[model samples]
Target: MERLNKPLTTRQERFCQSFVIYGSGAVAARAAGYKARSSNRQGWRLLQSVRVRERIREIQASLADHRGRANDVIIGKLEMVYHRAMENYQYHAAARAAQMQAKLFQGIEETRAELAAAGIGRDDEDRDRETPNNSPELAGPKMMTFDDNSREIDKACTQMSTWKKRV
Candidate 1:
């Protein structure tokens, strides 16, 4: 199962991409063309593979790095805006900047909460906590068919494209 350094088969690549998008083994398996009835089992098995897990981690790390850089730029600009507004004695502008900063902080807080809820940031000893798995980063509509699963993949691609454009 430890084949992370090896080349993946086409189906394996598809499965990895889909899993990265939706974070569901069953949905990703189905989207990768596994039989519907066996998708859950196949997906579970695939997820257990070391190669698959590694690929998923790689994708997530890349996204996180990209997002972190974007956030740094945004926060820097927001800080500048806040200072400029204050220095200009524009109380309304300053208030707006404050609101925007709050909103940005709230967004980060929400993401942190979501990651914690998803069992992502939990330590081994904290794995037994009763928090629900409701991470927005992996949330998607329940996939009833391959089309539904592929839709999530499409959305992920679109999001990456938009992020690149912004960057």
Candidate 2:
């Protein structure tokens, strides 16, 4: 329901923060103290509220901006380290710093290229996607979590072990 500039209640505020953290509506609702059984329903209802939606968007936008700023800060510090290492005749440290800088820039460039290929304008998308931590930027080995039949695998393994022992 849309209301005229309604301020979010404390629980609503907590829900926004938790939603951002977990990226799950039901989980966020539970974290915000909603009844466990009704958390999913409450989360859906909260998302329907215009005010709540706006707050979530605002929170996400701020985090995106902060992430971008953080990357810039990191690059700047790396540059300083590179210069200092070179001045101190620490060739190894200087080379390491240069390598890190190259990797960081390469990641950023890859993300930009991906965005372009996907038809996302540099200025139009959220800044977070351009950072090195983002998958397109990281472009290397990644660990994936899969929810497979682990219990069944365990059972099968145990049965196989027992059969081998008997044989």
Candidate 3:
């Protein structure tokens, strides 16, 4: 007697090949002259026989192993990219903060020179004539503004420290 589960015929072979290549089982079944679309279910069941199932399982296992190795490579590459991007961000942030600090210092120095030129001090050698309650009470507002700016810088530095730790 002929086996009920024999391999596919030439027409069925063409159907399976077209289905796999084009990802359309209906089209494949129509191309194979299967009048009913339900014939695709029969084709699928035949393909899932014991021997075919074992072969499919083995192929899938091999593909999965290869995919695991490829995933490790991809993760390593992505981690390096993340590290480099973080380094660039940190470098630019530090440079910008340094530039701002330098500008603030320049402003302070200019205020000092102005105070010296005005000669409004108890002592000629006193460089801190801008201090509150010191000679030249007019420097109070400028000194208070500078102190506020310094506090803002300190707060910014603290925030950066916290953010760096989290990152």
TM-score of each: 0.42, 0.45, 0.24
Query: What lDDT tens digits, residue by residue, belong to model 3 across residues 41-142?
Result: 755753555544444445545544543434333333333333343355553344344444456557656877887789954344233434565655554222
Predicted candidate 1 versus true structure: per-residue lDDT over 95-147, tens digit per residue: 55556766776786798799988888844423432335845434322212224
Q: Pick the candidate with the highest lDDT.
A: 2
Candidates' RMSD to native: 19.4, 16.6, 28.6
lDDT of 2 by residue, 60-128 (tens): 778656645455545655666666665675555655666676688678779879989999886734444
What value of lDDT does candidate 1 attain over all alpha carbons?
0.66
Candidate 3 local Cα displacement, residue 145, angstroms: 62
lDDT of 2: 0.69
Estimate every model's Cα lDDT from 0 to 1.
0.66, 0.69, 0.50
Off by over 4 Å in 2: 69-106, 109-167
When 1 and 3 are scored with lDDT, the better candidate is 1
**For model 3, the run of ten residues with the poorest summed lDDT:** 139-148
Error of 1 at 83 (Å): 35
Which of 2 and 3 is the better model by TM-score?
Answer: 2
Candidate 2 C-alpha error for residue 148, in Å: 28
- C-alpha displacement of 96 in model 1, angstroms? 24
Query: Of 1 and 3, which scores higher on TM-score?
Result: 1
Looking at candidate 1, the ten consecutive residues that score lowest on lDDT are 139-148
Stretches of model 3 off by over 4 angstroms after superposition:
1-7, 50-167
